[model samples]
Target chain A: MQLLNNRSAQLRAPGKRVSRARVAVVRAAKTADGPRVAIVGVTGAVGQEFLTVLKERNFPYSDLKLLASARSAGQKQEFEGHTYTVQELTENSFKDVDIALFSAGGSISKKFGPVAVKDGAIVVDNSSAYRMTEGVPLVIPEVNPEAMSHIKVGKGGAIIANPNCSTIIALMAVTPLHRLATVKRMCVSTYQAASGAGAAAMEELRQQTRDVLDGKPAQPKIFPLQYAFNLFSHNSGMDVELGYNEEEMKLVKETRKIWSFPSVRITATCVRVPVMRAHAESINLEFENDISEAAALEALAAFPGVSIINDRQNNRFPTPLDATTKDNVFVGRVRRDISRDDNKGLDLFVCGDQIKKGAALNAVQIAELLLK
Target chain B: MQLLNNRSAQLRAPGKRVSRARVAVVRAAKTADGPRVAIVGVTGAVGQEFLTVLKERNFPYSDLKLLASARSAGQKQEFEGHTYTVQELTENSFKDVDIALFSAGGSISKKFGPVAVKDGAIVVDNSSAYRMTEGVPLVIPEVNPEAMSHIKVGKGGAIIANPNCSTIIALMAVTPLHRLATVKRMCVSTYQAASGAGAAAMEELRQQTRDVLDGKPAQPKIFPLQYAFNLFSHNSGMDVELGYNEEEMKLVKETRKIWSFPSVRITATCVRVPVMRAHAESINLEFENDISEAAALEALAAFPGVSIINDRQNNRFPTPLDATTKDNVFVGRVRRDISRDDNKGLDLFVCGDQIKKGAALNAVQIAELLLK
Candidate 1:
């Protein structure tokens, strides 16, 4: 361990590396009006993050139920001041729950998410199961909280879908500028982190880096390519006819759906980098109207969960390390696209913790929106 | 060393991990008309590659002179069983030299290149010093060899400039498709390597990684940001008015000059990655004529110094490790841009050894063209 760069700065962006938020312990002093909350798929990466986020945000709940697959059932999970045994998720799990957070795979979400919603529980699903469905609202709380504002817990059964992690991160920075001057076209190149692939992929990267440092060949168990000191196109299945992968399509289609615009031009090249949790994107946008650097910067600065690290004189910009374990998407390299003669094109480099803001935190924020 | 991923899989792209080519040892049995070569900045990264490229190409030389700064004047360098003393580069260094290959800094090249040309030696400069100059030809041998065909050894002296690494790597992959269908606009996002910043940055990355792994701070010496598992925008000075860096401007300007198509729109976001020596670029191009994936792949495959690694089924594509110390530019992700309504847009991922094809190998190829 002493001979290597083994430390990972996940969710702990540099310049703000110190973690100040500790998990808050909430006792079982609940009122009759408080909601009953259930965390589905509680053993997985994003699943575990739901608990941490709920604790850190001091989310109030009258009853807490932890559910997972059969393999993880009977496992003990310590959250706040309570020790709870993980129960295997079944049709009856959401019997009296007012809100359920789903992060299991698509099939699991497809099976259990609808069941949870039918049981009078508002399901905030972090899977692609409900997203892109005609009626399901794909929400990024800061970007489109109004899209799901009509649904309230204990009133009706509903499903609020979490946008893909990449989409969540990109839109957090782009939405503000889009409001200033409607985005006509968007060209995005993503430097995604291992966390997007799940906990196994993150472990695979860490172990591979260890193996490669020990002069061993990186075993490609989780991914098909070497993930140590190398980057490659996204591991998503490519749509042969369109030449776009499923991941790229998510960014393109999801953006249009979330913004409620059908004809917005979007293109993306998504590549997986060796970083642990934070994802960085190089986004170029062409707007319908002229937008200057000062205007664009101002819009990004005012956006919630967005930070400006653009120090051009010092050449300091956002890196994955700067967004590790961070809530805000770090925006920098904010500039005009010199290729376009019209003052309509702008470029930005964005970094955010895909596991946090892109997943659990965003889902929790959506759940918070239900209270309002 | 044992605790880190110190092993570099340079030639280990797919199945080819073993390096087969040994450095050729050449004796001075050349004919009378052969060129006398002087390698300026012989102690630097590209300077070292110039020697390797010359040896691998079996370039004919009657005599070889190794020239560096005053500090390295007396160091011994062996070539093809001939041990030579490094000489300090002065105004008189090119007195009898017929050809000079310069990998020195821009100032050194700007100062000595004109001197060498004045002393009857054609200088093939591998610096940004003369690339954008009005009359100087910025040539990528495979892309625009004819740009400097008029200059040759033993004739009147002239300066031939090597295009920027990002430009060279991109053009190698783009020029072929551009020939098939004229490119009207190009958008490039580069994942550049440490070598383009010269050898010290490479060493800094190595030392920094070791220091960081040893639980010590990554002291940013050559770069402002942490180089171990972190990336940033190109460290080149920014153009405040244009909001583009010197490197991004090089790609935008050099592409136009090399292609001699001034109206073509080009924009580049140059980023520095942690990769050791090779560069990877994600390029999206819009063309005047429709080009299919078959046609684009065919064009890339037919190009002399370009290779296609686009394996959709296996999810295999060109990676930086595949291009390390390689002569060919590895291209992949040959697909139509899904966002385009017409067949006007295409996307590609390209990787090339910046020190080799981007600099030394390219400069040496110019020398070969001069011989022809």
Candidate 2:
């Protein structure tokens, strides 16, 4: 274990360090002709969600290992109706695993992910840890599957990153249209669900709701403030220069990266809503060229993994309730953004289950690519 | 009644004719010199809210008349322990009333309001009726107190229109700042409460919430769609030019008009939330010159009727729960609008009880001016 930690430290340097132990592990897994899987921080919110996705999607796996902090070790969880005991993640946790899913905090992923990869397991990290790493692929399977090709096999396994939850929900609606028309700028306001904050936050929302309903004082624990029937700016501390929070900046950076549009400008206001599951976004886009409402609708309708729910005549549109528990991103309230130049702009309302398409589902889709 | 309707038709345009025969009867109780007041639509949501505001503010009045639709007529309501029976509105009902508070639907106001005014009573209308009329003052007491001067005296009674619920809440936060710096443009998305749709709509939200909790089917009647744990675009029909629904467009127009900034460009997305009381708005504004966040916060803090709840360090920002049943508009999450130039931009999260400041409170405040 100490030897593995030493090798991981070497890999953490800016320039890559070749690790013989990682290469050996990958070679052994490859020779066995069966995929080995490990889940890092398997007791966290996204970690638990990833487990559900793997079982529901029926990911091809011969061996599955659940790893978490020493504090959560020895806990039993049921995946695919099979109880699996969590093991304390150590330097050698990924010795025989072929694919590792990391949903722990960024700091943990930053310190341990490279070590796991060096020990031969491909990492699909659901954190900001290596998302901006120059050589790493930040993959949203529906939008950028090609990025997955960069994953290395035996020589220090490749690391794939997932975009932030809010970014994924917003881009899911616009990426298809951007492919049709060059999206120049976008203004978005996100109504994010409590679950996006993690499991404890969701529990806080439920408790606060119960408290408020029962005429008891709401004592918020997980969130910085009460989450009962309230909305607030994303929890990022104030930014002096742009007034954009850390979450908003993540949306801007991740969307640009995922869409491969470096020059496209994005501004976002991420809000925490009282909702428990899905996230809703109100987006206004300015395109380079004219895109008629009909044309935009048709383009969106044809996009994979995107569903158009606009029916102004019947007063129907995509809402969190409609998108909850669904894998597909729902887009609606599509109209030409009359506030912008004629025919060159559009306004849309989008909703998607943050835990699904925004997190676990996207991770599962990436794992599916491994089979192909 | 036919004669009264005919007379009202001659004074107004064809489409602006007030309905006939409906009047609010006021039983005068002698007092030294105070005016006699009557509240129409007294049994509905806004009307019930008006009762609270009137009693809390203690607006001087010698007599109070409570009027409702014929279906609710004769129902007894107590205010400060004085029981008042709701009387059906008729053409001659306003004979001795000095001020009438009108909060019925637009059609009801359009039909009967003129008769109230014709019968020598000043009406502070909570409906959209006569809002755009040339001589009518659309008042928000805080924004345009001088507009109340246009209220007629005795014979030809003046009608003061209250702005839309969403508009009043948004403007309450922006109006004070717009006074200091020139507001060039604004983008707003409203999370409006079900009470804004009236009594039945609020009941529907409660029922839907119950149904959702019990795993029963949610049948939406007041709204065109389900209101349980969901949000939707303002259900007003799509216009021919692909502009926003009437509700969305009304926020834009009313804000500009109330601020007396007709040229200020504004875009709005009005969404209906399952919330029962307060309406929350995510507002982004672009100013004419550089407006530092410090300066914006200072301006808002000093502004009357606008409370600053922006303690980001403690996450003590405003929410619907914080603003519910409160008169002041709760403004927080104050930051710079990163999408625009820093010096000339600000983003704000504001919440206010839509039934109160948005409708009933504003109307009562205007009526207070009539008393003076």
> Which candidate achieves the best lDDT against the true structure?
1
Deviation from native of the Cα of residue B222 in model 1, angstroms: 1.0
Please give, as one word, the docking class of candidate 1: medium
Write model 2 residue lDDT over B300-326, tens digit each, in one string.
Answer: 888778998877555467878788899
Q: What is the lDDT, from 0 to 100, of the residue A138 in candidate 1?
A: 94
lDDT for each candidate structure: 0.86, 0.78
lDDT of 1 at A7: 16
Best DockQ among the predictions, by candidate number: 1
Error of 1 at B339 (Å): 1.8
- Hey, what RMSD does candidate 1 come out at? 8.5
User: How would you encode candidate 2's per-residue C-alpha lDDT over A1-372 as one tens digit per residue?
Assistant: 332333344445465544676444433332334576788888978788887777666566657788999999989876542356788988988888778888888898898898987887788888888887887888888789897775644545878898888888888889877887889878788888887878888778767766766678888787766666566677765554555678888888887777777778777778887777899999888788888888888888887889888877776788898898788999988887755547777889999998888888887788777656
Q: Candidate 2, residue A94: CA error in Å?
A: 0.2
Q: Over the stretch B292-358, how does candidate 1's per-residue lDDT look in tens digits?
A: 9999999889999998898877778899989988999999988888777999899899999989998
Candidate 1, TM-score vs. the true structure? 0.91
List DockQ for all candidates. 0.50, 0.34
Q: In CAPRI terms, where does candidate 2 land?
A: acceptable
